[model samples]
Target: MWVRGVEWLAAAAADPRACTGDWDHGKGIALLEAGRLWDVLSVPDRLGLLTLDLLWRPGMSVPGPTLIDTAAGRVGFFLPPDPSAGWKGADLRYATKGAWVAVPPPYRPARFLEWLVPPDGTGTLHSPGALAGALRQADGALAVLAPLCGR
Candidate 1:
């Protein structure tokens, strides 16, 4: 049942078979296009962590699914499709239309693409406005601390 549910979640991929085929073949990960079911907002691990902290603080709501690429020192947040969002940052990358994101089975443990906050198969995604606001706050906090930390 869990496998079936995970497969259903995987259907968000542009090519569901390719994703399941790779998993069935033991590849453990597959590439899925963005801007169809959702988009991906990627930021450096440091800033991402800070943003997450702020998002989940005492009175704040928890964010949607999030992934971390430890090997690349980056983190990705799953957000609703917004091709014209125009998100910009010094070390940020937004995967919109025509871009791809490597995703792992929702329940499986991955090497480098582990999920910090796994999806619940509800198709819930982060709000672009809330995320942008949190990101800006996190970035500003980082800038303020960078000098003190000698960065």
Candidate 2:
């Protein structure tokens, strides 16, 4: 079943021009053309999870707003509006490379770990306490999915 899915994805990547819809445009289509859909999905998850862990550790301060480059212009994403939001205060901004965006003070860090793992002993993707274990499981799942995705 997985092999078949990979074959289908490969075929889709081979001719992304056929993709037309709100969800398929610009870089998204280009990624398909490059046969990078799997990587596109997985790499960000890995990076986001790692970044979350880094942010969650003790003594870690909130990161400034992030700029994600786009053809239009620079947009800023901030981690937190204030310290009270805990780890849920992050915001994402889009923008072009080399643009400088102002980061407000008391920014919140990402809660990827919390989301992926979970706290409260009751686990949900939105919780943080289970991050380490969730990450381990995610790694295993990714390993299995990688081959199926042709990664």
Candidate 3:
């Protein structure tokens, strides 16, 4: 995959919710894959592309540059905004049971609730059991897709 420049790649590469872009407002990102061009909408849309390359897609990763500039300014694994920034890096060793999953950088308190109760929803949040159950499902999916993980 190839992108235009730092700003474009940052919006396309940063974890969907972590970059804090108002994707709902209809921002467009241009990208190229397999020599074809695409105008992707929203960070989540770009995330899906990156997910194939970085997460579940099968193929040995060719060495490439890792840093990307973001709307929050330039950032990398070492400058975690908080403790939960662990997922912002390239390793899954922090995940429990070695059951790898893509834990996006904003998976902590602030954005965690957004994933649960939408901004306009009732003030309630999902219970701990709900969170754990979801993780279990994800880990199970990862196990089934391990061959595609290129581990």
Candidate 4:
């Protein structure tokens, strides 16, 4: 099933400059899939012609928040900014099972949510659970399409 998805992704990439708006965000998913599965996990957003990939992963799980390594610096997840507040900026409180945990930040937390790919360079952050989620989502889609394929 993944093989089929990869084929589709490859076809999409063959065209010069795939547009996320043209295909609902499938282009970013294809880009993420092209890399090592565990090395990249991102949610792509379309802003005009550019796509913003929001990537995250879990770090060490502890009583407090876990720290994630990013180009900017290490940022926390799960842990809230204030002990009184029940939620952090956008970090998932409880990431999927086996997900790494990151310590929560105080101000402009998502700033740590840097660009997944720089304008002129290449690199991606690896998050185990995020990768798993992407795979599962892709697989689930295949499962649904398999019946329609008549095989």
Candidate 5:
């Protein structure tokens, strides 16, 4: 059952119906604009995985939908429109107005891009504060482990 929210999001594409059509034909990715419905923060997969772990830890709030581009070795986290600054860096890419993201079907995984956490249909998104904190922690963890790993 396709959620109504996902249906509405698909409509934002240039050819709204293309998402479904491509899915049926086995090419399931649609380019959608960012900053309208939400903004996305693209981070390295290692950091993303660690941040996700923190976000899902006991007592922490559940995060919003996230996408992983295995081919690019990056992860995308969906956040509310026009999120505050300080989350940008070489590894942290923010997609805002005029930027387009190759979004996979919300219901399931796609080829190059797959959902790490699928949207729940409601307009829920990651809390910037929580995400930022978790990201910082993840960064620190990596920094400490890098020496031991000889990377």
Candidate 6:
């Protein structure tokens, strides 16, 4: 069954211009074009799951956008990896401009250990629950997500 679905997605990707013009749905069509079979296979179905249009496929004014404006409202999506101790539901990382983040199954709350795995692994370690116990601390800077215009 999965193989047949993959094959269908492959066929759709072969000629996206022939698919529906719906932008949001088009993202799925585009994903089939840019993503690997394993990645597409990882997609989970939920009541209102909307995957991020992050693939550099055809018909996209912006290849990889954090969010999109749909008929319902603004939305975003992500897939978190976890097999056990997981009741994978939807999640919202950072929704700007009133965008509501959506998540499918197999992608939910990231466990603490998963968050601990940092790149390079050379950064200073902050023990979990050491919020006010730190001897020294550095001031933080305000970071913001600036959406790309005309995307």
Better of 3 and 6 by TM-score: 3
> Can you list the residue pairs that collide in candidate 4?
58-100, 58-101, 59-100, 59-101, 66-102, 66-103, 76-102, 76-103, 77-102, 77-103
Clashes of 2: 19
Per-candidate clashes come to 0, 19, 0, 10, 0, 0
- What's the candidate order when arranged by decreasing lDDT? 1, 5, 2, 4, 3, 6
* Candidate 2 structure quality by residue, lDDT tens digits, 1-151: 3233223333333342343221233222222321122111112444344444554467744332222223323222222112222222123222222222221111111211111321111111122333334445655766787899899
The per-model lDDT (C-alpha) reads 0.82, 0.30, 0.26, 0.29, 0.82, 0.23
TM-score of every candidate: 0.89, 0.22, 0.25, 0.22, 0.89, 0.19
Per-residue lDDT, model 2, residue 65, is 21
Task: Encode model 5's per-residue lDDT on 1-151: one tens digit a residue.
Answer: 3466467567667676776677556577778898888889999999999998889877755678899999999989998878455676567899988889888788877788988787777777899888999999999999999999999
Clash count in backbone of candidate 1: 0
lDDT for model 3 comes to: 0.26
Where in model 3 is the C-alpha error above 4 Å?
1-117
List model 4 lDDT by residue over 1-151, tens digit each.
3233223323323342352222343322222122211212222222101211123225522121123335334332221112232222222233332343221111112323422221111112333444334434544565587799885
| TM-score of candidate 6 versus the correct structure, residues matched by position | 0.19
lDDT of 1 by residue, 1-151 (tens): 3465466557877667777878667679878888888899999999999988777778766678788998999989999888998888698899998998987777775679887777776677788888889999999999999999999
lDDT of 1 at 129: 81
Model 6 lDDT on a 0 to 1 scale = 0.23
- Scored against the true structure, residue 68 in model 2 reaches a CA lDDT of 25
- On a 0 to 1 TM-score scale, where does candidate 5 land against the true structure? 0.89
| Model 5 lDDT at residue 40 | 92
* Cα error, candidate 2, residue 55 (Å): 16
